[model samples]
Target: MPEPYALLIEGGTIVDGSGERGFAAAVGVRDGRIELVYGPTDQIRAERRVDATERVVTPGFIDLHSHSGLMIFADPLHEPKVRQGVTTEVIGVDGLSYAPIPDPTDLEALAHINAGLDGRPDIAYDWSSVESYLDRLDGLRPSLNLAFMVGNSALRIGAMGWDEVVASADDLANMRAMLREAMEEGAIGVSSGLDYPPGAYASTEELAALTAEAARGGGFYHTHVRYDLGDRYLDPFREAIEIGRLGEGPAHITHFYHRQTFPDGPGPMLALVDDARADGQDVTFDTYPYEWASTRLLIMIPPWAQSGGPVQTKERLADAGVRDRIRREMAERGVLFAGRRAWDDVRIGAFTVPELIPWEGRTLGDVIADRGDDPVDVLCDLLLAEDLRVNQVTPGPWTETLRDFIRHPIGMIGTDSTFVGAKPSPRTYGSFPRVLGQFVREEALLSLEEAVRSMTSAPAARIGLDDRGLVRDGFVADLVVLDPERVRSNATYDEPRSYPDGIDRVVVGGTIVVEDGAHTGARPGRVLRRGG
Candidate 1:
């Protein structure tokens, strides 16, 4: 009857995404939804059958913070994520994304600044609103489901241009209206990158006002806080909590971590979150299980120096006087890239200039030492030559400290992955599997079920996706079957592009997108809209 349903996954131990011990079951799928979850002995029939005898079946992983929005259309296969069982990703993170742009000039500048994280793919620059952009993605048929967050920088540039001026009352109102419209259009929430301009240029009051508007439209605020190192590190976290309190929505801190520069350590940092939650604030955070971070090298330049967008910043980099001033300011700030401690830790991950290809995979300290050139001069010259499309990886916090952050009750996982770089961080391909392999199996930092919950249902609940993220009846069938004994991330810092092992099958919307550890070239992903 009815073709006996579409597919059946038989004899797998179902993790169920609930942080509970798995039980043997046979799952049946029909019309893109889970039709039945019966005992192993039940007489189930289907059009197709997968023998998942020794696998742990659970909901496909969800990446809470990803930069894939930039190049998903250019490279939609996305084997790196799909192989690791990530069926859904939340893009438009760190307060930067392509959407709601009224001016073509603003979109160009954004593309230039974000090139390092999202590659400059050859595609038509046509769409200009959140709805249009999502439509564009749907037409491309990307490998995984994607959700968007309207970026504060996009709203700022749309309203105020790339100037350093604070928003006037009218400017603030326009920005709030744009935020509301974007949320209503389909965006899941509002995201702010406080360390990157013009988002960095926004004052606390301006952000609170915009966030309040998003909350009114039933969306939360996701923030890549202003700073994570030095004396003012905690200040940004405090500001995020304050914004959430004032905005009256859930606050999600992307890539939450304690840096090596933190004086006290993870204890105090986690305490800040606990204290905020105790104060009736809805605060949650996500962290990748890695000891290195990847981002644009242009971030080292102070905010004031980067005032007039990429073109103006390039001009400043070319001027001798301005270059010297920037160098002096960076030196005095004791920031990561500017200070001596970071010299050895910073490695070039990607470069747009053909001349700098040799420097990729090389440390900045080595380049400087070999050339006998000034560090600041090298950095400025590189930024100018590449037009701000360079990426770097730097050492993160201590292993023990990072472990503590992940084991925290409120902690979830986000890759913060930039897949454009040649030598991308291993986290790009390995974050979820690494948790299952290293943290769960190897170290026992978290139980297998607990880790699965963190990666699957936890992030889904955070983003308000009610239908997916659980292996249960009547849910959309986004599922993964893995061999727990062999599931491990093979990608390492030295070689980052390789896929993982033991992910046997992946299904999205009842279609087998990945089977027997290889992508099946099926595009069943949907553009997930808020309140849909």
Candidate 2:
């Protein structure tokens, strides 16, 4: 035999990514898989050895909910994820994705809906269904394993072309047919952006039907609820639990905290999620360790005005009567001031327009304040000029609500930020590091081991990825080695593109991608499709 093939990771204190205690172990790799975990010995010959003398080795992290779908294919060298010890990422979040469109026009609309994913090179809008989209991912390796959730908005768009009107029987049937098609193509579940259209346009009954179908396929319903701030908070959560009960699918809430209504609060929010879990409808959630959340600026518009397509939305904004009505409703809603103030702390995280570059790091209120224009009008005109596809980042304070959620036994973490090369959001670069370095260490919120589990084992089990979470014999050798004391996120609000620190080495599928905290330019990552 030509020199027995093997590599050894010697003397590392392995955390195993299973919430178990760390212990000194030598993990051996053979045939590109974990071969054994035991005390070091002199018998076995090997090809390489990673001396992890003072490091903590755990399974590669899995991002449960990410908006980095297109970016992965756009830049396979995933600086945003792989550097954070993440070896897999779940995409097609917020009930919107760029796949499964039945026509070119619908594809264009989906692009506008998820403008945060704007940097992918121009590829033909050729895939006409969800299966085709998954197929597209298969052709592109990127740098990690990936799974997906079918976007409910895409389903609606496929059936009714973004109309706000209720679906007819035929329309509902078509939507169900597409949902079935996506599931058959190996989608893990369904997601809905209820706060954003055309998902918002769907009624309780419509959502129930779609989720019920997902349940039939053994999937869950992941949602950005219809409302998550102010007076609308608890009710929407209750509605989600109710939907889960009625549809027979588990419910996974996105982001998992309140921002607008109580930017400085989150206590009540934890109570609500706990209440749902206690009731036993299979409720779960994920969170990023940041005070701010990001989304499109389109949410500033009134619901009625948002009903029509983008051109109509622009026309309504220009009409004096419509403009006044939107302002009046915004004022009456109490959400406007709350939203605007929150937006004040927020910055333009990423956008395409050159004019908006000056406003990128500035607050929304400051943008209008400095310009001497009404905030409402400026908001409307900005959306119009940007063609309703501008991306924004809203930075708020992390309250006790988030802390409590992080402490929950079932709560996992997900950096909802997308990677846009140099324009990445702070969460993309700092989420896990901030949690380990700042939130857990400086704040003394969670023990380091507990925090690692939240990022590794917790998410792996949540998504049913069995082989990669723990460092054990028979497990995939996807791991991260770090110096607990030195690990920290360096990316900041004003400069969001910085890399983190303290990551000693990162291995994906037993191959080193990050060596001595620097990328080795290796592309060993794989696209992990369900049941494949």
Question: For this target, which candidate reaches the highest lDDT against the unseen true structure?
Answer: 1
TM-score of candidate 2 on Cα atoms, chains taken together: 0.92
lDDT of 2 by residue, 1-532 (tens): 4354367877778887767778877788876677655765456567888888887777788788787777666677887778877888888888787767778876766676456444344566677766777777767756667888888888888888766899988998998888887887788778888867777888777888888988887677888888843357577777777788888778888777655455335666667767767777688888877766667767667656866566666788788788888878777876656555654764654555787766655667787777787777887777777677656676543554567777677778878876543444688788888887887778888777787788887777666677778777888888888888888999887677888998888888888888898888888766565555
lDDT of 1 by residue, 486-518 (tens): 999988888988898989999988889899999
Model 1 spans with C-alpha error above 4 angstroms? 40-42, 228-230, 337-341
lDDT of each: 0.86, 0.75
- In model 1, what is the error at residue 499, expressed in angstroms? 1.0
Model 1 compared with the native: what TM-score? 0.97
RMSD to native, candidate 2: 2.6
Worst 10 residues of 2 by lDDT: 113-122
lDDT assessment of candidate 1: 0.86
